[model samples]
Target: MGIFDVRKIDCHAHVLDPLRFPYAQGAAYRPSGQEIGTTDQFVEVLQCYGTEHVLLVQPNSGYGPDNSCMLDAIRRYPGIFKGVAIASLDADLSHLRDLRDQGIVGIALNPTFYGNDFYADSPALMEKLAELDMFVQIQVQHDQLLMFKPWIERIAVRVLIDHCGRPTPEQGLAQPGFSALLDLAETGRVHVKLSGYAKFAKTPYPFRDTLPFVRALVEAFGLDHCMWASDWPYLRAADRQDYGPLLKLLDTLFPDPADRDILLWQTPKRLFGFGA
Candidate 1:
């Protein structure tokens, strides 16, 4: 069977229906034009791609801490979507439990967008997440992974690293941040998303410069600990990105059908409780 005909899980994407749920006050960036992926649009697009499940992440742009848009999508489409929210650093445990009940499976932190200092006090929230069996999804660039070195294991939660650590392709594989992410694989508690190559690739899509980094991640984390993501709507994107072409890249990356199954289906099902 072809890739699309096989069961696949998009472990990361977003639901930005600003028309129904307006952007938050002082929201950092406003996603306009092609960046807007309404809940309905997301469902229709994924349906066309035969993606059976998705994890909708809250974007810092337009929605900020107001996870109403994402939460609303989860509620509206019951089983099809799960969420990674953006509750503040020291959010209350009870509030987290409420979010969990509302289909939020984790928290999303963007050190790349807000910087390390903004998340300095995150350990408290980290501890709470572990207590509740929720994960923390982080987006960082360059050496920023080093900043989380101290806290990641201490809290002992399932950590999802976004966009291949958003590494600098010019830095080669040894760049400290990406290297730190590689090392975390040994801990058996970290997972990496193989998406967003366009976000950090100095070269354009197909993002050939990022190929070496992805191979290294797959080698280090293993296909069992790594999964596929689309960063749908390609928000804040450097170039135009769409679902089919991005999904088709899987064949090039993993020529073996067994390996493709592991990345696109097995890992997400095991890690995030996706699919039947």
Candidate 2:
């Protein structure tokens, strides 16, 4: 089969069903009243884009630490879905173990929401996650990378930094935080997701402006540590973003078939424990 023909995995996406799982009162943001990202719709989108597997990240808009929606989706669609949940640093081990038992492979920490010292404040929790062999999925502001570096270095668990460390195109590759991010990848424990290009891109679709950052990251981390994802339901940009084009970016960025396979399938399969 051709490389692009092989079904791929989307390492990041969220399925929100407000009717059944209402948004938390203090949610950071809410979906349009009329539109909800249901699992079935998300699955349809994945199928349309040749994605066979997905890692559902708990939406901060879902408010509190209730991961019922994401966990339920995993239970209902075993093999097709895996998840990363948001839990407080002080959460109990039993609760975390339960999440692991339910096919949650990682814990998500958003420093943008939880503050810069989230990792530092949760050393015990980080150790527990390491003990469980679960990875930490982190989303932090671009400048926070250096601050997070020491904690990431000391922690034994695997870490996947979201949104290419959320760097802006204007910042350039030499920006201290992004440089630190690239340096972290050398540790062999850091992985970066090639998602959220639109968030930091200075220009419109095709997002060619951000290609240099993607290329630099790939060069730094290599295919084994790099994975591609479509931040589906693209939130505010939903009307503007589509899955096919996003998936095709890898093909455009990585001309070699083997490199495409690693970014689209192999790396994620290994990192997230997806079945062959």
Candidate 3:
């Protein structure tokens, strides 16, 4: 572990391996040719950045609800990794209990990509998540934040917002989507990850355009309500990016050592209930 030896945990990360798992049949987008990310590969990313633990978020590429790869990582390294399952609103809930037991902390929901009619609050989906004691990880458009608000309040489990809510910089701090996210954070039950900035950037390189929006999230949610993710393999990213530069950008975003510690590790530990 490099400078990240300070008890850091990567709140959000993805494992993309099509050869081994095979992309979701006829999926919207598939990585051209990526190898399976085994436990060792994940560990290398963490160690290279000094991240001691990580929360594995299910990618939209493999929408099959087959979380075998994510589960394998957790099982192989019980203490260092945790998983978030990408669940289909159409699937059976019984399968969730075993995933929960296998260290799956939540369900990754992507309504926009999958074109689902059930908004976050759909009574049917809520019932399923509640049954297994899992949280809901949502990837909603910056405008859809309000749609999930009711569900967040009604669901017994915590709700995590993905990729800064994919906010547009023009929306600034007052964007209804970002505003709703702040409101959710105030409730203390919602968490947001400052991952996927690449998706929100307008131009190239640093995606510096999203700085104000990112800062607003950190300020509104505070360190405890926020977490960091590498969004590995740079999938669905608007621009080509490397993981090393991304980590450096994060260091710049949270310059203070304490804030960095919380964003990188401590808050994630508390959020996912992961051990140091």
Candidate 4:
């Protein structure tokens, strides 16, 4: 089967419908024009690509601690969507449980937005996530992963690192943060997203610079622990990145259908409990 024809899931994407859900009062960066990806538009993208399901990740760009938009989409599309919400640092246990009950499988902690110190209390939040069986999704760049390493080491929460830890491509895989990300795989509690090449790739298109790291991540984390994602709507994209090319990249990275099966379907379903 063709790559697009193959069964798959969009492991990372967002829903930004300002018409229905207005941006939060104090939202730092409001997505506009091409950046806006409404729930209906996203559903169409999935349909066009023959994607089976998707994980609706709440970007830190808008809609503060409120997850009404994502939660509402989950309710509207049960069995086909899962959410990774953004909760405040002091999110109480009950509130978390409520989110989980309503189809939120995890929470997003974006260091790119607040920097490392923003996650100072992450360890405690991680403990709660562990108890509730939710993944702690982290987005960091360069040496930022190192800031949370000590905390991650102390906690046993299931970790989902975004954008292959958003590594520095020129630095190679041995860079401290990316290296630490590779090391986390050994703990058997961490998973990394094999997407977001545009976020760090020095070049465009095929993103050749990121292939070596992708190889390293697949080798270290194995196929089951590494899943595919498309930072869809190509938000804040440096160049003209799109959804099709993102999936096509997998063909170059993984020639075998079986391996794609694991990365595109099984791994995400296993980790996020999609369709459950």
Task: For residue 83, give model 4's deviation from the true position in Å.
Answer: 0.6
lDDT of 1 by residue, 1-276 (tens): 787888899988998887899888888799999999999988999889899899889989898888988888999987899999999887899999999998888998899999999998888888899899999899999999898987996778878999999999999999998889998998898999999989999987788999999999999989999989999988988778989988888989998999999998888888778654
State model 1's lDDT.
0.90
Flag regions of model 4 displaced more than 4 Å. Answer: none
TM-score of each: 0.98, 0.94, 0.89, 0.98
Q: State residue 133's C-alpha deviation in candidate 4, in Å.
A: 1.1
Candidate-wise lDDT, in order: 0.90, 0.83, 0.75, 0.88
- Looking at model 1, residue 4 earns an lDDT score of 80
Global CA lDDT computed for model 4: 0.88
The residue-by-residue lDDT of candidate 4 on 1-276, one tens digit each, is 988998898888988888999999988988898999888888888899989888889877778677888888889998788889999877889999999998888889999888988788888889999999899999999999998887777888998999989889888878999999988888898999999899989988898999898999999999999999898877788778788888888888999999999999999988878766
Number of backbone clashes in candidate 1? 0
Candidate 3, residues 1-276: lDDT per residue as tens digits?
Answer: 333456677767777666566677777766664424545777887777677788888776754577877777788899888988876665567767767888998888886675446553455665677676677888877687677777777767677888889877776778887788877776777788887877877767577888887888778888888888877767655556666787778666877787787787778887778873
Model 4 lDDT at residue 250 = 84
For model 2, how does the per-residue alpha-carbon lDDT over 61-83 read when each residue is reduced to its tens digit? 66457898888899999889999
Kindly provide the TM-score of model 1 when superposed on the true structure, using C-alpha atoms: 0.98
- TM-score head-to-head 1 vs 3, winner: 1
